[model samples]
Target: MTEIESATTPAAAHRRPASLRDWLAPPIPGSALWGWLGPLFVTLFAGFLRFDRLGVPKAVVFDETYYAKDAWALLKFGWEHKTVKDADSLLIRDGSDAKIWEDGASFVAHPPGGKWMIAIGEAIFGATPFGWRFTAALAGTLSVLILCRVARRMTGSTLLGCAAGLLLAVDGLAFVTSRTALLDVFVMFWVLAGFACLLIDRDRSRRALAEKVEDGVGGSLGPFVMHWWRVAAGVCLGLACAVKWSGIFFIAAFGIMVVLWDAGARRAARVRNPYAGAIGLDALPSFVSLVVVGLLTYLATWAGWIFKPGGWGRGEVAGNPLLRPLEAMPDLWRHHKDILDFHNGLTTAHTYQSWPWDWPILRRPVAFFYTEPRDDCAAARCSREILGIGTPAFWWGATIALIVLVGVWLVRRDWRAGAILLGFMAGWLPWFVPAFGDRTMFLFYATPMLPFMALAVALALGLLIGPARQATVHLARHAPSANRRLLGSAVAGAYLLMVLVNFAYFYPVLAAKIIPYEDWDARIWFNSWI
Candidate 1:
């Protein structure tokens, strides 16, 4: 065999299994107790932020007019239904669930999964704002935990993982979404969960392959490794899809991500024909585990509507191709198409509609709730507002970190960096599609990508700290290791503190805290923000 070809081929991989065992071992670092503790601390902080005065504004804010009511309907009725006029005022005025629903069925734009989640809160809290938003807050808080754990696993640093969680917790956009009845936070939660599951799968699958090598199984195609974690990831992605169609992008992105990750793992282990082994041994299993399983889970989320038979679409045993719901009703496919059509043409000029490009910059964040209340403040002009803007420090830092990650991934061939970027792309890049760009979009649509952005920043911090692995990437006669480590630590610490301070300064606007109009105006930061 040619020298280069032999080196590259899996057949030559039979040389020895010693290197593969050490190379494919887990990267998770530190004690299990500390790891759990650090992430849990951040999660508690996230919970506090999300749960504090969740019912504040005490009124239906922005899209809450739809989602909150839909949740109530879903809890009481089996599906979404029309509400009487002035239902918001009536419901808020008396905190009563009486006389809200109209006789007609409501056509919802999104799937019932999110509303069902909201319904869990309403069911517990009796249809009040706090009740309806409860599950969203919980989901948002749990997302912090998931991100922390996932980041820890990826970077093998509990400190960095906690930093990622804290970043997500303190971000104003995440805070506001959690406190209000919104679907984006739930979408973010499921997406983060799916990514976390996949990360675990990656480590486990790689380690299993290493074990196979240690057993002297060579000169053969890659083994069929069990992927329970991957199936769990599929379920998470499916739940994401059930929450919003946008999750389908992650399904596609992550599906491809895992396959590539597997191929790379096999290649690193010097398997014979790594690509073929991955393709032949892994692809079909992945399809069944992630795709088929995910589809089934997504379909299962519609069980409430399916069994009730009063859903917007869905007729007796499915009949005409495109008939109206009032007539020989259509099947789930046509029903779903109606939703797709609504979203495709949803370009009605909303005052707060933002372009996809504006999201990363935090331009034109939607004001979920705003009021110049008559009392309950020290200042003459008091304003209470919940503006859904991200922490500028984290978002902007992450923006730069993404650029840095491209270099890091190319230079180091680090899968973690690539994984972070892939996640951000799966959640954010699809919004730039020309067809969807024409439709009205909002900054909160970027919520599902927040954890990835946080991960990017955390991963950057770890690299900055010049850990041994990173240091080995660039060898120098005298790299001034101590000075560089100190400097890197200082910079990372400063950046995190800046984000924390920024989050505190904007707390009033984020949490609907009543403050002097001038104070709220100062937090706006720019005219575009207003």
Candidate 2:
């Protein structure tokens, strides 16, 4: 026998052999075409769910009032302009743009990345409901495809990857956010893309390390490697930050995470002083890729405001003490500080705003659209509403699963579990720091974290189902011995079914379907939901 085969054969004789290669490698092997087909099919289903009746309730809903109008202004003026009185009625009802806006820049709080995306849709379809929301729907659909591939890479199981995508597809928060012209959905998409890029970097780097060791070139420390995937991750993360300042948390968290991954990889390759090597070789290049590259990409998103004149807060830094030292700098630098000041000074009270601690428990969901359709309905009373609440069974189950995942990571040091937790923390925990103040946070702010929550639940289900049956085992002899696997699989299947059923039950409220008032009331499980 070959040396490597001989080393593993003794363990294989007693039980299924355990190795880093087996743990990290793809679980199924065959045609790459078949591998992509499953995720593609799931993405199609997600598209249908998001695109059906997308222009319904043809009016501005919730924050769509601010973002939709801003997007249209950005398209026309190259910067956001103040709109005229009753702009919502003029745009949605009258469908007229004549004299709808005044001739000056508006002080938009958020950056222009998401508004620019919305502008693409508006430019194609005109300034209507569908036009404003088209890009959001597209981003949301693409997020499913991205999550499917990422999950597939992490677990090595195409089935589990599609499961993660399917769960995210039906999630009410993900669905609602996508159908609206809001910034949060864009943030979710870019953050998800960044995570997927990092996963690709991990696999590629490990393969290169393995090849080096097999040759005579392996040394006490692992070889330094080039990572195009990490650079791609930086670009995605920068776009995420340009969409919302909150994305900075992810950039910081993921920067540390990729370096730690490199250190762990070196240790797995039996390199001496693995941590030291990771810092020496991988740290500097990774910083340039994620931090420096990300910063430049973020600045590129502001080209509309940067190159043009009369943008809000542009050229207004003459008397400002903090910005005086930067008089030699461009107007864009002053505008950035103004945007930061606007965010820090926001203490406005809002009815539906909830704390971060309340998000995991489904407290204080935002009502995007609501109306009583008495005249058009056959019943005595009917209601149509779009509520941004998550699927109860899925969110609650994911909460429990995340706690368990932490334990798994601590005890077993599973990199997959650790990565999921890091993603959840990056999207979630930062909101708590601002929540302690007077910031007007809402439950929908948790939209970016929903994919990670779905991933945790899917990963837990994979563990419950256990490994596939050995091909060499005799069916009759192993049937009785395999009861534990059978039982675990049954339980996992039942749980997934429950989540599916829960989503179906809540679909009417989520999609703004007109239903009897009694039916709508039945779906509202808590008084707070109303």
Candidate 3:
């Protein structure tokens, strides 16, 4: 038989490729229209949910008292100014009171990136509850869009990608964080953006390596390519850190992830001494891109503090040994020390503060707003609350799914599973250490992990739905049979429907709609939830 005939034979078609590069080839293509349209539809739906009745509860909720005021101060002045007594009631009762704010600066624990973002909304909407929260809603909506695109790239299925986006859009924690003028939402947005950039970099780098090898320009050792996507990832991570210091964990985790990806790419290219080559060629540049660039970006976020005089910690350094080197910039050193001290010394007990381990299990959620009504409602008594809890079905299901993914990574060596785990760990593991300390933490700190949890659920569903087993001329497609595919797809669809129903059931409490007391009690599954 001729070479073409031999290649088309059934036996030959069943044979796998020997090269590592061939095994790591790009995923099969799917419908082009659904790729973008699916994500857009989900994002629009999320936007509606987040923006509707966003101004309700007109009073500041939870920590919004701190962040909202800080944001308004940042908008008016360059730094946060101390607010007068009863500022929350003052802001709610009297919209036009410039005198409510005191002149002196106030100490802030977190970085300025999130407050700066809130300032943009305050600038446009005039510092009301809705005004302070507008940017968070926008960021949350954008996160859905980003996750859809990232999931599509990771799973090679537009349907599954959109599924992930939809899951995140309806998640209660995501909605709550987005609607509140808190820093965690910004941290979630930026961390997810950075992870998406790294995904793009992985695909681009692998393709480049393949192309170089195929062109016969080089042998096993591939050319050192300049990856701009990695730089973008670094910038995103830096912005994440600027928003919240906890984002530093993601920076560390993702930095290691990308370097390992480089080594894997080289090994797939059959490069001799791939590990050493990766270290010598890729590691240093990766550090400069992710770590050094991130540091500079973080410093840039302090421009408002650096240039303005009389901001908190702008003077009077205590002459600490470690901070003395920064004495030349007294304001910078003092500000850094002050923030460090505030975070480390925080031991104030809060009723809603939860342990980190409890976060994944939906325990002890923070109540952002709540009210009991006697006459406003038809019922004898009614409850209105905005609870920062996740959709239990999604969160609990994802915990199990993530555990399965660990096995998938170990046994199947699936890169997607590994990536999902890395994303989840980056957001979660750091908080576990702080849980042992006196510092108060809440379940909403798990906000950054929610996207990864959604991704994990999507991936698990994709596995259940099986592949689209199209027939080829040479080989018989026995696995992923038509009946099997149909059954799997149906099961996956049913699960999604269940998630939608759960979200609907909990929507009242999440959005703070007044409901009969008994109805509110029905939604609270446990005493801890109450």
Candidate 4:
């Protein structure tokens, strides 16, 4: 035998076989203690990118004028109150009117769940740039950690997981969105976290089902009818929905996905009554846990509105005595009806607004901020400021990768590809329905799904590398050109280096730093980008 085979043969003979439980454990080849290092590195790298120069521009950009002030009001009054236009200037110019805020109601399109998170940051930082944006940056950083953990679990490779996290970190849109004070970042973080929780639940449930089958009570493959993880996933979905109503799509998609998974599991276990057991016993409780529990959690997010008297609609005082119960309801509740009406009626045209069909191509994008600086020697004329659009390479490559992943899943049945596709569908596809109704939306609405897009790219790269041979010795002895494997690794490593370099090149524009007109123009690439 060759040296490699001879060396492995003895170890193979002496090896104590692992139990089936060990096989079912996540493909964490490393010891459990070492596995956490990947996530830690991802978190640190993402944190550095988000927290560096976090207070630059030193003013609220875009929607921060509303959210930052509302967050402060939430801290001071225990609920959000109205603020005047140009509130950012007022808050920044002097400390004289720091505590002066209007007690009237504010009109808004989105829900109040994300506002509470922003309130936490304002409560601590006291309405400064750092205070309002800190939570968004922090959430963005933590999302990298979540992506690492989830990708590792899905692919059974910590290295691949770290790669996915790195891809997300280098994405210009993700970096900018994270650093800016925006509700969409929170929505992204919560949706990703919820999906990660469901993935964990899927693995745990599969292992539980396997154990039940081995115990010979394979009738329904369960001695227990209820599942705790399903309830936990329900709670995560509810929290995600609380952040944004769009989270309902994920809840519904994932709920159905889980039912399908249980059906597949029952069939694999050779149960004759698979459909009945999977649906009747397994699915009913799961539906209640996912849907009903999610509904309750979403309602709980409105507690402040329910309790407060001065909120938007809480002040209707002239209703009939018999209608007191409905009219005397909290101000926030009444405010919600008006907000809902506004959202439904927002069919007006906007210059930067884009259709969902155009979103995939990024045909039109909102300009978050723009400024033309005079007397700038840098460009021989002037400088420009910009903060909209996405990284062309990252988004375009991910777009192609998403298409490839669909084919890969169809032909190979790769579960990881399926999971990424599911997230993309849940986050992106539903926007098309509203777009058909002429709802005005921006490309930033696609921000929440960008991480999953990155994950799809990373997953495709992993597949390109093929299966791991890290623990295999027999194959190495038979293959002649062993050095070629290192070549493949080198190419992948070089590609990753290119991604990091590209991210650095765009960091200035992404952060809204003043750059020469020529430099800014070069980065624009397309007229529509301006």
For candidate 1, the TM-score is 0.91
The C-alpha local distance difference test score for the whole of candidate 2 amounts to: 0.82
The list of candidate 4 runs beyond 4 A from truth reads: 1-27, 31-34, 94-100, 218-222, 316-337, 374-386, 470-488
Candidate 3, residue 206: how far the Cα is off, in Å: 1.5
lDDT of 1 by residue, 103-148 (tens): 7678999988889899898888777888888999999999999999
- Winning candidate number (TM-score): 3
Ten contiguous residues with the weakest lDDT in model 1: 1-10
Please give, for residues 187-285, the per-residue lDDT of candidate 3 as tens digits: 999999999998888878777776766666444455786778889988989999999998899988888888888888887666776777688878989
Candidate 1: regions farther than 4 A off: 1-19, 93-95, 315-330, 435-437, 468-480
For residues 24-93, write the lDDT of model 2, one tens digit per residue.
3323443478669999999999999998998888988888888888888888777788988789988787
lDDT of 1 at 261: 86
Clashing pairs in 4: 313-335, 314-331
Off by more than 4 A, model 3:
1-28, 93-97, 217-221, 315-330, 473-478
